[model samples]
Target chain A: DAGITQSPRHKVTETGTPVTLRCHQTENHRYMYWYRQDPGHGLRLIHYSYGVKDTDKGEVSDGYSVSRSKTEDFLLTLESATSSQTSVYFCAIRPQVYSGNTIYFGEGSWLTVV
Target chain B: DQQVKQNSPSLSVQEGRISILNCDYTNSMFDYFLWYKKYPAEGPTFLISISSIKDKNEDGRFTVFLNKSAKHLSLHIVPSQPGDSAVYFCAASSPGAGSYQLTFGKGTKLSVIP
Candidate 1:
């Protein structure tokens, strides 16, 4: 509840342009994730970071990349925007512990590739 | 294949009644299950969760039931109010104590009529 924030609440961009979405966490959690929500797909993970300078691909990592320079911030970048990538992007934080590991999501950023 | 599935796309219930939302999963390895509520323009908020070790977990007016044998779980909201109306998502993850990632259902839209 006290931990996550996403930038650019809403954005409209043309195709072929690059876009970057940012996620910031104050809890200093070790794990951060990026996900996209579509009409049929509830939420699909794009990429996640386990620690500073450590990141991994997820189920839907195509055309998306992520970086974590610091423990509190993660950035998801789209090299070339397309209509297919247009959706509500969400940033989440999950602790390393599995038993009590709960993931909290950001408010979400709506990106439209027109 | 999709491990998590929500058969119902939407449900409507009268205010002050029991609202039950169902979810099914194909994965047997999932031990941690969570339910989330999402309103318009907001991220999904954690509502309740039940572990595979337990058949049921309750908090306030919300209760979650997990049936390991059937690979099914349901969320019951007693005395539902208009404020309870929102899209409900069911998420599941493996029980291992490591970097955990969640798979979510398509979500069920619950409309509580006043």
Candidate 2:
């Protein structure tokens, strides 16, 4: 298994509140990604980082932000929580080596907005 | 519109039987395909992958077949076990598309009955 850890495995927040999910990896991977999984939607990328301080938005970047100051840490923040944002968020890392472009994922963070 | 589609929402198979999950993509630029397995309340794990240059790739009990001409891919699990019951997602990407992003399908739930 990849040495990826997501903080606050589960959380419940009220609407309009701020929420931040942290992803820490010990593998020293060059690329990191944040994705959300929902019923009927599967996993949608929110943001990803290619290197330290280099990040880009993904398909579902609305209302969410990400920052990566170090190679081992990637953070995803929900500026204002919404009911629609409730889903399981997963952090993934891709090794620099060619492993058929495979990305390993963390356990997951469950978030709920009421 | 969804670029990657898994038309079947769910499938069931008896233990020790073969389980097949299908996926299709509309984008012609996609050259890399992958399959992931996920259980309830957990992150998705990479299962298998196949490059466009190859038509098939296998690992142990899992085999991935890609048909570039049809823009379709399928995952086959031989002698499926109850523990193999989970949601399977198919993803595709184009290395030349700029970012290291993968478009995923809605996923198919596989139920392996005893």
lDDT of 2 by residue, B46-68 (tens): 99999999999999999999998
- Candidate 1 residue spans exceeding 4 A from truth: A96-99, B96-98
Which tens-of-lDDT digit does each residue in A2-114 have in candidate 2? 78999999999999999999999987899899999988898999999989999998989999999998888999999999999999999998877778678889999999999
C-alpha positional error of residue B50 in candidate 1 after TM-score superposition, expressed in Å: 1.0
What CA RMSD would candidate 2 show? 1.0
Shift in Å, residue B95, candidate 2: 1.9
Tens digits of per-residue lDDT for model 1, A1-114? 637889988999999999999999887889889989898899889998889999999889999989999999999999999999999999998854553656888999999999
- In model 1 chain A, which range of ten residues has the least summed lDDT? A93-102
Which pairs of residues clash in candidate 1, taking residues 3 or more apart in a chain or in different chains?
Answer: none
lDDT of 1 at B38: 90
- Strongest candidate by lDDT: 2
Where does model 2 exceed 4 Å of error?
none
